[model samples]
Target chain A: MIVIDSPPLENCLGFLALSSYVMTLAPSISRIVFPKYKKAFLPKILLKNRRLIGVFAFLFAFFHGWLLINKRHIDFSDFRTSWIYCQGIATMIIFTVLAATSNDWSVKALKKNWKQLHRLTYLAMFLLTWHVWDKMSGHWTYVTPISMVAILSTTALYFLRLWYEHRAEN
Target chain B: MKSQRSKKRAISLGALMNFIVAIAVFGVGRVVWQGVGLRLSATGLESSHNLPLSAEAVPSIPASHTLDNQGTWIYTVALSPEGSILVSGGYDGQIKWWDRKTGSLLRTIQGHADAIESLAISANGQILVTGSWDNRIKVWDLKTGNLRRTLRHGDDVKAIALSANGKLVASGGTNNKLQIWSLETGQLLHRLPADTWIQSVAFHPGSQTVAYGSQSGQIQVWQLSQSEKPRLLQTLVGHQGMVGAVAFSPDGQTLASGSADKTIKLWNVDQGQLLKGLAGHIAPIRSVAFSPDGQTLATGSQDTNVNLWNVQTGYILGRLNEHRQAVWTVAFSPDGQELASGSSDATIKLAAVHDLAREAIANSPLAHTVPSERESDSQDL
Candidate 1:
């Protein structure tokens, strides 16, 4: 039987979550910063499937949590003691909340507060990124270029959008 | 109305396509990431080239010597028969001799132009043979720390084995060729072309046969006779990855091979058939050695642990989890009292096997969970 450590698989799942989360932000980018490109096929497709992608991201995050728990053999004692464990547990809680509210019924019930509650995705993404960076503190070479590109490009896009809005106001 | 229905169906199809595209991206991205990481790590280009950067951070394992300052990955380690001197060879292209008791660096012998990948000590403890990525095998007089002679190969030498009599030395490497040479004269006796890269070589205790394990997962046993060329005796095949180490039990009755597949397989030497496979290591098995009494087998793995297994029962006796990186090689002192493990973390750990095993039995709950011999054997088959 083939045996492998759970880290690589966990890292891959994390990357998938990050990638889908980044894609979910594409609609906002197109609408605010690149309205001329809003009608583009890629942007429109990503915009239409934003909710589905968000749900998939949370699903991948949950699986990543399961694998991490199995690998670390973490229990309530570990969750209470270690800061690294606390970071992971907190990240999983955020993802669970986001996934639970990702449906249309929750969107209608929460109404205006739905968008406010879904903003927790940003916090989840930040925690997930921090968790990955902490785990790979010394060994950054194993951190995939795709995750780096996705996270950085999303940040840059948001910053550019803010700069455009500020200049317009001025 | 018909156009509206078609548009809704198209949107559903688009969502399905988007999900498929996302999965494809994730799958392809993961594969590429893993591929690049493996290649970089294999070539020693990973960001953290050494694990546990300082000697102070090393775990408190009960080793007689925790020799540090090698400054690079140690690929192989050997203990002299007298158990007084320990030698380690590594990517630094230097073979270091240490006082086994004091853990002090006795001397540094350097001549190889590249990384030393393998080392073998003669049964008589007179000669030390080292094979290097420089495509050369150099024999040294252990007493005087003098280089006797150097034998050149077509490619980097990956493994070396010295006969019990200390007369014949078998060397194999990336060239896919196995060469048997006289240790005294450095004359090549026989050159056997192999099907794949030979990662490890070992001579039977009786010195009548030599076995080498290859990257293609085949272990070939060659019988050495007086006049004729070495005859291929048996080709044992079972491992799924490169067989990195091959060792014979002290009695020469059983041969154990450790592989990149993460399993150690025991073969009945006479029949050339797999008897049992030990499967505790979570990563590639880089080295394997049997204790002097031949009752315990030690395997060093990329998981950074050295596991000792009961030879007769295939039960895990204990695990030495001191190394912070891949444990490249393991060796038992001539008396079988001390076990030495070399790791990519650039430290050599020399622990008293008996004391370590006793402590593990008394403390570790996992030690009591070893599977039965019958169960392990059936599972292996």
Candidate 2:
């Protein structure tokens, strides 16, 4: 009954959009659900398991790209130069950081800097959501409800994590 | 008294010479063969007998190839029966494939809840099996890249291998057992028992026998055709560290085992005798593979190099030092024309076995890096 004019074709795009939203919340969920045992708890050689979660997230992002960059079977050539593509380009960049640091060597090589670089994943999550919204124009109606909920939920987790870290530092 | 001292000095000199010879031979081996003569590797080994590039090898053009992206830490690799596919498993619990030619990412088959420690592709190229830390073996359909089934296990699965016909698959891990499955019916046909925690498994050619190595430094052979009860056919004991990998020669007369003690041993299967001990790698050796023809051996190591050895002489033919990080997995193309390796560096590489014949690699995996810029825009954090 809440179908306030959202197109049927847009729902499929919503599929990719939904996948992204689900992925964007992974870190926040992992923190709240299994706080004591985030990826750092796995064996050293197996630490890539944690980073692998990021790989799948990025892959879902790519599938999102394929759908947007590809309309029908026309290919990347046929798509309009939408802001969504730029946002996609942005999301891929953040994912690349998460993916690159997936290795122990990358962790060790980058040292303290690696953790900071990975923190960029926070910026990327919202940018990617915005990118998805940009596809829907002013009314990506189907996605907007969930997006608003997720953005607020993730923002709450973010601030809570920040305050906790700051209090611990004190 | 003078004579005794002179004899002692002579004996010491002989010992020194023997040590030097062993080190020299271990470092590299030059085997002169019929065709596809080797182009010498920079590490000073002559691999004249590797598959001619025209046969199973193809020159790499990196820009055209989108190398596999599986886990951030790769542990194992295997070539599909057709050699057109390369499967790599990583510490990230993901198994990914790439086109053998262009190295483009063909598919990412996901299911394992933990790191995938090993992989095996069925000989007919129909199924790709993986053993994971999640305590299971997953059988995947090659063409569709879908997770077909998950064979539950009791502990971490360290190694996996498939038979030549694509009918049987084997997995070895935590409980010191080799679990064999029938791909056709999705039945786990048998579980090969072990004397200790088994580390690796390899199927002998043309038979139901499987050769496995263990943390106890013992390599046991289990014949599946006759009985479910594994026989203590041979205990290939020599290495001081754990036996990491084992392979049966194409002819089935010999078996090769590599260990963490930094030595590779060839055992006479029928005789159960240690034929020769190959030592050269500076660190633990991870996996060993025999080329299709059985004349050459490919080995990956913690030393970050893949060494090709002459099976007959136990001599190092040449060293492939391209992975930059530890080269945990290696496989030969079905036709024996190419060689592929997966490294901890998060990339899979294909080298034309024949390209070595040209005397110098025009370009290697070391020279190229993935598009690092791909990360800049995508982060949601």
Rate residue B231 of model 2 by lDDT. Answer: 61
Which 10 consecutive positions of candidate 1 chain B have the poorest summed lDDT?
B51-60
DockQ versus reference, model 2? 0.01
True contacts kept of each: 0.00, 0.00
TM-score of chain B of each: 0.81, 0.74
Model 1 backbone overlap count: 0
Q: Write the per-residue lDDT of candidate 1 for residues B1-381, one digit (tens) a residue.
A: 999997687566545645544554464356446545543443346654333122222223466667895447788999988999998898657889999888899999785766788998888888999998666789998888899887877666889999988889999987788999988888999999899889899999986799999989999999987699789989999999989999999999999999978789999988988998888766678999998877788999876778877776665666677776778899988887789999877789888787544543443335455543322321345
C-alpha lDDT of all candidate models, in order: 0.75, 0.63
Query: For candidate 2, what is the interface RMSD?
Result: 23.0
Question: Which CAPRI level is candidate 2?
Answer: incorrect
For all the predictions, what are the DockQ values?
A: 0.02, 0.01
Q: What is the C-alpha RMSD of each candidate to the true structure, in Å?
A: 13.2, 21.4
Tens-digit per-residue lDDT, A13-70, candidate 2: 5455445544545555456444776655443223323454455565455454544322
